[model samples]
Target chain A: MLILSRRKDETIIIDDKIEISIVDIKGDQVKLGINAPRSVKIYRKEVYLEIEKENAAAARSSDALASLGDLFKK
Target chain B: MDNDVKQISIPSGLYGFEGLTKFALTRASQEPFLLLKSLEEESLSFILIDPLYFRPDYTPDLSDEDLKEIGEEKENNLYALAIVTVRPGEDPQMTANLQGPIIINGDTLTARQCITSNPKWQTRHDILAEIRSHQGAESC
Candidate 1:
């Protein structure tokens, strides 16, 4: 992992298109401001990983799905 | 038939499977749950549900940046679909991954899964339980 030290309002440019800046820092929480091309998508690393794990788990056979029997009755 | 399949491009793909760009939305055995299948790999597919159908209260906020990312001007154009996780032979229950919903642009047909700002929705939301909860309240 590449770590860089930047104070509030400091910005980092990537590929000359994407710009990430530290908007504010208060105690443990840090606010970031990102400016990138419309094509670029951003997400939290932990949240992305959680979705990926669920996606993989959902990728099961149709037979397995049907064989699971019925959902709980009312 | 080939005409039945809905072709879509996932610019960022789904989390771990970012390499796959071309995908097909095919009908699943279950109603309201479509199969998000990868055209490149026959074995790759996921059960997807429009979370709104089950949880109408769910309206995740879409930022201006997120809208532009998918080439959308209106927030409504970005369709939200939640991935459904099913465990076979044991609990036999289905859960929707509400933490991050997949948003697709109607015009561009490009999709990307994004995290919701609303913390109420979690990674696993029980569909049947939600239905029952709503149904139970309606009786009162």
Candidate 2:
């Protein structure tokens, strides 16, 4: 992992397109501000991973989903 | 299998299936659930539902970047859907990921799965239990 120390208000540019800045730091929590192109999509690491897991589970035609056809109407 | 298949383009191509872009959004037999069938991969399909249906207070304020990503200007023009997760059993449990809501632009047919900033929302929420719990409160 590439570790770089940056103080508050310090900015890091990626590919000259996306910019990440440290907005504030207090205790163990740090607030960040990201500036990227509209084409670039950003998400929290935990939220992104959760969505990926949910999407993977939804891809298959599970017995639970398959049986849902009769569950809702009933 | 019939008509009413709306072509939706997920620019980000969702979380897991990032490669697959084109999809067909059609109504399922039930009113609450919709079928998100992928055109590229025939087997790739998912059951979708509006998270708001389960949680009326679920108001996910999309960031400006989220709106631009889907080419949507007004937030009202965007339709949101969550991929349903069902557990297999005699009394199967179904949940919706309110944390990450899929935003779609009706005019442009562009869509994006965006993470909500709301602290109240969760990745997996019990859809059936939520409805039933609300029903009891309403009757009281």
Using TM-score as the measure, which candidate wins?
A: 2
**Residue B5, model 2, lDDT:** 84
Alpha-carbon interface RMSD of model 2? 2.9
Worst 10 residues of 1 chain A by lDDT: A65-74
Candidate 1 error regions (>4 Å) = A2-44, A61-63, A67-69, A72-74, B1-3
Question: How far off is residue A22 in model 2, in Å?
Answer: 8.7
Instruction: Give me the displacement of residue A50 in model 2, in angstroms.
Output: 1.4
User: How well is each residue in B11-101 modelled by candidate 1, as lDDT tens digits?
Assistant: 7778778888889977676566777889998788888888876788988776666666678556456688888887755466688988878
Q: Highest DockQ among the candidates is held by which one?
A: 2
Each candidate's interface RMSD (Å, one decimal) is: 3.2, 2.9
Could you say which candidate leads in lDDT?
2
Local error of candidate 2 at residue B66 (angstroms): 1.2
B131, model 2: CA deviation in Å?
0.3
